[model samples]
Target chain A: MLKLIIENISKTFKDKQAVTGFSAELSEGVYALLGPNGAGKTTLMRMLADILKPTSGRILLDGKDISIMGDHYRDSLGYLPQEFGLYRNFTAVRFLSYFARLKGLDKQEATTRVDEVLKLVNLQQDRKRKLKTYSGGMKRRLGIALALLNDPKILIVDEPTAGLDPQERVRFRNLLSEIAGDRIVLLSTHIVSDIEYIAKEVLLMRQGTLIQRSTSEQLLDSVKDKVWKCTVEQHALPQLQKHYKVGNIQRVETGIEVRIVSDQQPLADAVNVTPTLEDVYLYFFNEEVIDGVQAGML
Target chain B: MYRQECYKIFSKKSIYLVFITIVLLLVYVHQLPTDMTMRESVFEELEETWGGPVTEEKVERARESMNAADAGEVSNHTFELRATDYVQFLVTGAAMQKQDQSERLTMLEAEMHDFDEGTYEHREAAIEHDMLQALDDVHGFYLIRSWREMFELIEPTTHVLLLSILIFLGLSPVFADEYTNRTTDLILATKHGKTKLVSAKLLASLSYIVIVFLSLQIINSFLNLLKFGGIAGWDAPIQGISSGLDSLSRLSYDGSPYNFDVWQFFLLTIALQLFASIAVGVIVLLLSFLTKNTMITFFVSSIIIATPALLQQLGTTDGFLGYLTDFSFLKLMQVSTLFTQFQAYNLFDYPVLYPYLLFILFAVVTGLLIMLTYRLFRNQQISH
Candidate 1:
């Protein structure tokens, strides 16, 4: 059983604190770190990947400090950064083979694994083609394939599905679900739906701080009865958004269909609805995710 | 791993571009010595009176013949001065008509150990001192008859020097490539990324340097031999060649007899240049780690590498600046100057050979650069 314990981690870059006092103990399941852009999701994932050391606190694997553990700890760690890149001139196969060598796989093993990963990413036909010619979705899939090269116990990926198409996103989510198995997969994304089905636990973050951590169901239950779809006149939509956390706003034939998460109903005819993870995300971080960067300073 | 790193370094089209550029430059600039053709022209011009090679009898006869000629014809009494014994040529020939030959020779010999206060005179004296020291035990001097052999050996070095510069260009991107491609995150995160992988890159760069250096030397050597058809003065002291009006200089040999033949001196020069190339490779590799931009590293590296040559061209190679520059860098690559001049840094009243001192200094600098590269890269935090 692999265990990773992050104790009071924080990162300060110049005058900005990108990650602040994040602590977690994870083992054997997919944990979705949900946050919007610039919410320190990337920074936290980088810390877990051991690519960026926290300014304070210790990250340990199996009770030993990852910092002191170094490469030995890294051997069981796989990371796919948000802005992943491959050598432009390197063919897909060569790119994977080169990385395999760096990961300390032997010649025959690296070659075999390169072929396997190429097939796993569904890029076998394009394995011999230069990476510069690969499409966005293909590159993202290749990045995922690279992350799985060493079959690590801990997998950390940040904003992985941002460039992928909708179909590819669903496929990728399924792939992540299958690979998560008995390993800790910390999947970070701002898109709530990406992890709604697969994430065993959801960690909600705003302004570099963890606001909440619970199962998806528990998170949705917290916002139960809070989500109310109310039919209102088009003119009343703006006022409704101003007073409550608006999850979705749409215009209809007669008026507008508005979904808002709030404690009290704004309309008498509004019906209570079950919250999706999106509604939960909107409930906890509706105002904070958008205004968090400037809000704390104000 | 090293092979892969080398592929990253050498397989680029830019490397081949640089190689082709250097090859073209070598073809244009490299040529055998011209001293022989010059001597033959002089011999043809003076064949009526001096129809034979310059000997002691020919010298006496030419002096007598000049004395009997009319004053107007005295100006026409000139002949090519291609004598290997430069001092002896000065004394016997009419090149120095104002000063007595015997007194000038005595003054030059005296200046070997003693110096003058006047700036111009001191420099001239120093030059002469070094020249004489170069030819100290050199005997049986002769005029330049055929320079084909002499030039064949020296011409190829242009390619060597140019190839060294090309090496800097080829290696400027070792670290910057990862940054430009945005692969540093992946590469540095791997298990062996920071340690063995870095080691592999360094080894690949060094091995490429060696291969380029040795290949250039071999190509030049072979082409030179093929073109000139002989190594005539392979074992002859350089003091035996009269270079017309070309200034004579000599290489220092670390207290060994100043009696090295041309072959030994050429070999030493090649060795010194190779050592300098190693230092240059390390320097380029160091610059590669300082930033994640290849252009910046290449630009700064060009400045650093060319500083020595620029200082020489700017005439900063004389007193204080010269003392340091002479024992530092590209001076070792100047085979002609080292072969003809006995230049040295008089350190602590001991004339230590510049090449010996230079290679030692390069080794230390390269070592420090390597350490600095490791420290910088190992502790690096990617900001972009």
Candidate 2:
């Protein structure tokens, strides 16, 4: 019965608009906010977190304005910002207890919850260690543990896997997938593969606007038969890149090989290939390459 | 929640370091007046002056010799008399306050001797005869006691200075650290972040102030007892050991109305001082809540706490300007000022006196500051 509806949301900085006329209604599922740098994913998540008041919009939790709901709204909401610093002197367990108290948990309950989250994040052994001694990945896991302290019905995590290693990222991805069944988990990331197989819905944003919303397969199916593989001479690669949206580029034994998204074949020898979430992402957000790195790569 | 906040403050070594430094300074400052007490040689000097350890007979003989016309001129200066061992302790210390006002003291003593129809006291007595009526019973043969002179004149200033520094350190981080630590987003998103958590932090800071104030009070009182002898005559009249007296029984005319003994006045001074000290803590917290920067809060708070004493030093301490200092935050810290019955101010059409008016002003301001601290801390946005 949990619902969050964001309507006509816009955030304008002094000179530029960070998010504009964005709207969405979310129930319970793992919803991925996929975008390139400066796509307003963090801005949107911050608004939902209720830390940043919107310039214009209403975020309704179960049909009541979240701003008026206040503590009632905060009780059910858990947020992990893109970057936050832990109080350096506090041991992990003490820090968790501080957050639990803020969440209105009593001492006995906070202690139990702290132990539970520490174990869930695989930091139970290191609970007594000072946060300054924790590795970056361990700190990232600690952030996730804090976000889970309330067992919030609506969880908002911005760039949750940013500092984690590949192994830790996989573990986190699986963890989020398991926790998303009953909560409205809004996960924002630029990594297409992180949520490719896990998210129930993928929200594609470009230039501060939601360009597309679809199921994982449906997002890929939109570009089906439109992605093709072609090989060309190394000297002709730049020319080929200009005509089509290139996703994966690799060196071949003969000519250079490239996978691209185009409505029709660009060459007589081009063959259709199944599209990845990455290919779809490149088609939508990587049309303009910068500094020889594609937007999706960034 | 309060215990959790207490843990945050108590677990920090920096707070403990500050507390220890202040306590050591207290021990050193409290030990300062020990040599001024009754040493064996000082008592011997009294024996030499009066031909024996001072009994009433010998004291009368010494007074006769000093007042005799043949007595050698004492340099137009009021030299210390060979008082009883304990009274000698009070007189030597009381001389320091006279030393601060020697220019005025000499003028007043000369005026007392003139006794002309146009003399300042004669004219003042005629103008405010009713106010001056109480001097009818004020007469000869003065008595003396320690009067908390050694402790009041010295310790209260040291107490205020050290207490302000400690309060600034304890409260400057009450709200500002959340900004520096980047814990604002997490806290602002919590259910009790704006209300209950802020209340807990303030309660913790205030609890610290009260504990430090009471500890310093008890320690300073005990030290005064050991260093200057017990306040056995603490209940004696202010006239007993008052500085710059015109007659044996004549104390400060302004203080005459209250008729409070030194102990009673000292108790009131302690109450006013503790209120002002805690108010200082509130000022630091309010500044920290607004600026969200601890360094700015400390330096600014220090400037405010120091300005009053500096102004009293630079400005005239007699007329309108002196009366003005009674209302200052630092002026109350000097407990000796509370015994000066010479000044009264017209506050709100009622003649309010020092120490009493100061207490009311501090209570009002501290209450406002508490509300302001809560409002600013709760409403501030963590947009960064």
Candidate 3:
């Protein structure tokens, strides 16, 4: 059976469309929800989580509508909000225990669960320390611990590593990879690299619409020959940005080195380069596609 | 649930300060002398009675001789005749015997008249006797005390505070906090985080309120008894029905009238003060929910609670405006006025109408505020 299905979901705020006609189905493994700022990625994820009711469309988990399932659906779902809040005074253990109770575990069971999750997040030593005393990375780990307290079948984490240090981010990425095998793990992030290693599939969103859904390999393949690098004068950078979708620009000792996506080489010295997931992301999110390359390829 | 909330309140430093301050204030009040003279000009009276030069050796000797004769150790005629002869001898020199005698007689007569028939002396004696009786009555109350009676005394104030704090703090983060903290996206993304968690929070907050309130009331009552002695009488002396005397005369044993028994009035005053405090708490909670900031909630609640007293004070002399004071929750805190009898021109004019009317009005307003708060919470959008 499909673990989760979202059908034509849309959400609007005041006069602005946040998420529109978004649909997806997942059975298992890691799915990366990649988008730029204000791309309705978070909105679509929220609707599937049942935290937000969609203006139109239905979300079904195991063939049961989540809106009707209510708390029962939530019982099997683990969620980490983008800006997760904590009761600053609470110790990490105490905080996890509270969430465990809310997730319907009794005292003895909650204690065992909290201890297990604290170990899973590698926060066993810091469990007795208050959240206010924790570093940003530590707090993020605690948020993960709380989300995993119920042993949820489907885990949803939004910008899970936004504030983590390089070492901690790598550790978190590895941890997510280890857990993604048996259950569906939906990861939403603006950072392409957070998901590049673990995500089996990538879903791109732009301006409240699903721009693309494909394997990480397929997304990279689509942008393979389209991305090109060229060295240009400092004064010519702005002109290049206007003419083409500039993915990256680095100021060298001599002038500026630029990475741009185009179907054909636009400059004499330009050379085709291997494309990363970021190249595909930049192509869809940034305006202006090359003449021969279809925008749908994004 | 209640135990958990109690633990939270007990953990807070602010609640500890409130408890300590109230206990200290109660103890300080209790230490005040119960036999205090109420007259404003007590010092002047003392000055007028004792401001004179000391008597000389001759006058002292004469007074001593007369005192001895009055005790019947010697013949009064012999002592009086000798005293007169000695006074006459002194009168020829520096002594003012006649003036001294007149002053002595006036002082004695005044002392006798005051002790025999004055209201202060009578009331003082009555209070001394009543206190002893009250100690006995305390034991009786303990034997027959019921949960219903205790609840009746406590529930109103407790409910007010509970409802007030819950409504205020519960609404604090509903919209304003989320917008300020920029956590709307994260919260909305969780499976049922927006809907389930918000509801859980509201439940937790309200539970905290009920626990805090009940604790405060229980602590207040215990402390009140410890400081002021135990409850023995449910009906205040002022509330008693008496016949064959005017309202003014019933308040006095002698011709001079006073407010009421200070101890009884003090107890009633504390109860009323608590009521007002709870009312202020409730109003503040409503404002907090509406404004969604601690600062706005504090300021708005203060203004709403204080406005009644301000209007009463400013408009008291304006006749029609005086009636407005009767409706104020602030006036309820002035327990002294509630126990005092107001004068009227005729039998048709009754003074009990004001407090009775005000009490009902406050109760109704409190109910309405709670209803409004519940509606606000229920209708609020769970998800951003």
User: Best TM-score goes to which candidate?
Assistant: 1
What alpha-carbon RMSD in Å does predicted model 1 have with respect to the real structure?
A: 6.1
| Alpha-carbon runs more than 4 Å astray in model 1 | A289-298, B30-137, B141-161, B238-259, B316-324, B332-351
Docking class of 2: medium
lDDT of each: 0.70, 0.72, 0.59
**Tens-digit lDDT string for candidate 1 (B1-384):** 888898888878877776767655544544524333333334334444443223556566555544545344434323344322232343244223212323545787676447654444456555545544454434333322323223322333443357556776778899888888888888778888877877898899888888877766666656555444444445655444443432111222222324566666666666766666777777777778776688888888777656777787788788777766665545544534554433455555555555556666667877988888877776676545
Per-prediction TM-score to the true structure, in the order listed: 0.82, 0.81, 0.65
Show the lowest summed lDDT stretch of 10 residues, model 2 chain B.
B245-254
Candidate 2, residues B108-155: lDDT per residue as tens digits? 445555656654464433323333333332211223223444334244
Give the DockQ (2 decimals) of all models: 0.61, 0.58, 0.17
> Stretches of candidate 2 above 4 Å error?
A238-244, A262-268, A287-298, B32-35, B38-62, B68-81, B85-157, B238-257, B310-328, B332-339, B342-344
Please, what are the lDDT tens digits per residue for candidate 3 over residues B254-301? Answer: 110122333454445556545554554455555655776765765665
Positional deviation of B230 in candidate 2, in angstroms? 2.6
Q: Give Cα distance to truth, residue B110, candidate 3, Å.
A: 47
Clashing pairs in 2: B254-B341, B254-B342, B255-B341
Candidate 1, residue B147: CA error in Å?
10
Report the C-alpha lDDT of model 1 over A1-298, residue by residue, as the tens digit.
8888989999999999998999988989999998766788888887787778899989989999988988888788888998978887888888888889888889999988888877877889998898889988889989988998887789998888888889878888998899888799999887889999999999888788888999999988888989999789977877887778887888888788889888998789999987898888788777774466467778
Tell me which of candidates 1 and 2 scores higher on TM-score: 1
